[model samples]
Target: MEFDYVIIGAGSAGCVLANRLSADPSLNVGLIEFGGSDQSIFIKMPTALSIPMNMDRFNWGFESVEEPGLNGRRMDCPRGKVLGGSSSINGMVYVRGHACDFEEWREAGASGWGYADVLPYFKKAESWMSGEDTYRGGSGPVKVNNGNNMKLNPLYEAFIKAGNEAGYPITGDYNGFQQEGFGPMHMTVDGGVRASTAKAYLDPVKHRTNLTIMTDMMAEKVILENGVARGIELTSKDGKSETIKVRKEVILAAGSIGSPTLLQRSGVGDAASLSAAGVEPVLDLPGVGQNLQDHLEVYFQYKCKEPLTLNSRLGLVSKGMIGTQWMLFKSGLGATNHFESCGFIRSRKGLKWPDVQYHFLPAAMRYDGRAAFEGHGYQVHVGPNKPSSRGSVSITSPKAAQKPRIQFNYLTTDQDVEDWRNVIRLTREILNQPALDRYRGDEIQPGLSITSDEQIDQWVRENVESAYHPSCTCKMGDRDDTLAVVDSNCSVRGLQNLRVVDSSIFPTIPNGNLNAPTIMVAEKAADHILGKGLLSPIDAPYWIDEDWENRQRPREPKNAMM
Candidate 1:
């Protein structure tokens, strides 16, 4: 197979790249994924986000080697193997983090990727259901909505009020408003159905003559000649090995774990490591698998004394009614994305950026797909939005694409442990608020026994899990950066016509969710590759600005919200 653009891993970024690049009818684009079709009914249902977490058919169920910092427990890191990638299985919370997050990227070597520079691309990729305004884009493929129609619990309301009481302002929109306060989460849903990247971008262009989507094909290696990426070698479903040629460029959108591993296998990584793995070195890019970062959350679950949570409706009759409702109007419980409300907030006073995020669930989340919960329980998941600890992912073998070396040095530093402690303390405070008093129940995880920083640290070590956003493996930076794999324009440093368009290229992890930002990266990268215009600055969202009062001007609600 030959293509003008051979994009690996049709995940969030890959889907967007395929759509934008193939928009030109003359360019042939090949988008490949290692998982099967996204035809499962569970995937279309919003609550089914967890249904595929353990599903090997559509999930690349990879685990990290036992982390000494995390009490020697290996974490299960799920990357979407399907057409939509992690976007399909994620909780669907739409967040771009603080403006300062990108500024840190600019300072770290990714020129033109600061908060002001990436703002327009954010606007360009999003069709804000809330409206077309300064804070949002009206004409984009991906749908963004505040999900205000969904009812929020009184305890949840108190959480926001608690934030206000704690001195954080009420941010009406996390994406539009500042990320420093507490508020309801905005989601990528259309009429309550999950609007994934495949749903937003790929589906519309899948039938285009210039586009080719290949699923169930595991990309094993990139074919490099004279320090340039020519094509890729992959294994088909039947275990047949084959090679695909590229005429112009080979784009690696294989994600944080896959991208770095594939690079090492293709001989474009750390010289000593590649040599140890029995592969000849092509480019001595030391940072290909270094600087790995991910967000970890500790969920506090409690059995609600009142029988009003989603667990109360788990019976057969309620299930039948939900099915009937979905059949009648494509709405109701069946159409709901698991996360109803969440917020980004600072854990301490005087922090420049938000350090914690919350995922307020209507029902208790059972980590293992088959595990059973006690009763109707509500959960508040507290996760550190950004952490200082860094890890790495490396290739262990040259042939088998099944295994990779993933070392998540979680809680490696005292700063990381302290940040998590503050996050836990804040979560406790919110749960103890007056609004949460009505839903009051004893803590099921840490309980009252956990108070000291060391106690919480031990609890977190036992309970913390991945929030599923992994990035910064093949970081984008200046050529002078010895650890840089891609340039600011997403081009691989030493390889010609090879670019990495995925979360792996994020020089620094954003303060919030990574999906929206990843899509924004592709939106900007497309124009960069086409040489359509000079890269421009992206303004921070109006909410995050210091001058929030002036930017919150009135607008046409219908159009702006739409």
Candidate 2:
């Protein structure tokens, strides 16, 4: 088959590209997905997120190489193998990261990627439930609903109240004028169903006749001829192989791990590494699989004094009731992911923006819902937003079916260690506040005995797990950057008609969840691919504490409370 664009991986970015690029009606666009259809009931039910995340059928279940810094333990890195990619299996939180994150991207040679330049794309992708504003989008594809603060369990209120009592400012919307504070989290959930990129971008446009979505098709390699990408070699589930030619471009939207591995397999990566893996090198880009980064979080669990947590509802009867409610009316406990309230804060003074992020869950359970506490309990999922430690994703063999070697090298730097210490310290302080005094119980995960920096560091090393936000394996930067795989326009360096539009193109990891930002990247890239002029940069003001360099909290009393 021949098409105008052949997008590998019908994930977050590919879905958007499919919708936008196929709008011309005459242009043919093919979106290939390695995973099967996202038609499972668990995928649509917001609270059933853990089902897809833990299922091998839906999750790639990639594990990192044993990290020297993380006490030599291998960390599980789950990426969505299904249609929406990680967005289909991620915690349904919607965060765009601090505006400063985009500014840093621009400063780091990612031209046209500053906060002012990227904000328009962010706004263009969202249909926020809170209505339209200079900062929030209202008429976009993705449906972003505000967490039901009033109807949420009391634990969410206590979490936010504790943040205020702890002297942190309370911003009504973290994605609005200010991001550094406690507030209701926005979720990519509309009417109690997940609003994945497939649902928002692809589903609406699938009937266009010009867009072809092929699921269960594994992309083996990019078909390149004389430094130009021409097509993709793919294998079907039934073991049939075929090459589909592309007339315009071949965009790699396979995500951080998948994209880098595909590039290496296609002989577009480091020559030495590719040669060692028995693949002849077509291009010698050293950065194809370097600069890997992710967020590592430890759940700070606390037994609840009151029985108001989700722990009380883990029984079979409760599960049945919740499922029945959702299946019938799309309400009850199954309606939300229960990460209703969350915050972003600085660990200490002198930071330009919030370096730490929080997702408060009213249950002491892991992401996969394993090892659940038997009684009422709660936990704060906290982690550093940006870690200085870097790693790489490299192919161990020439085969596309083999999982790539992923090494995040977690807690390898002093800043990363110090940030973990602070995250634990600040989280403990928040849990001990008067607002939570009614619900807070004994600490469960780290325990009260773990007080010293050394003990905290040990706990972090032993317990930290990927927040599932792996990114930057094929970073976008100026062509002058020695390690840059893609240019600022997301075009592959030293290659023609090939581009990468996914989280892997991030110049640096953002300050929050990656789903929203990945969608924004595809939106921006679509404009570039169509030869359209860039969106006019908006000068929307973001919240900044006047004394941020000197103090963690603002000096104004009004800023301290909602």
Best by TM-score: 2
lDDT of each: 0.80, 0.90
Compose the digit string of candidate 1's lDDT tens values, residues 125-185.
Answer: 8888767876688888888875544563454565566555544566777776466666777
On residues 1-562, what C-alpha lDDT tens digit does candidate 2 reach at each position?
A: 9999999998889899999999988789999998988988899999999999999999999999999998899989999999898889988899999999999999999999999999999999999997789999999999998646537588888889888878788889999899999989889987889999989998888888999999989999999999999999998888899999999999999999999999999998999999999889999999999999999898989999998888878788989999999999987778888898998999889999998999999888887775456788899999998899999999999777888999998888999999888888778877788888888888898888888999999888988888999999999999788889999889999999999999999989999999999999999999999999989999999988888889976633222211
- Ten residues in sequence with the least summed lDDT for candidate 2: 553-562
User: How many clashes in candidate 2?
Assistant: 0
Query: In model 2, what is the error at residue 507, expressed in angstroms?
Result: 0.6
- Each candidate structure's TM-score, on Cα atoms with residue i matched to residue i, is 0.93, 0.98
| Most accurate candidate by lDDT | 2
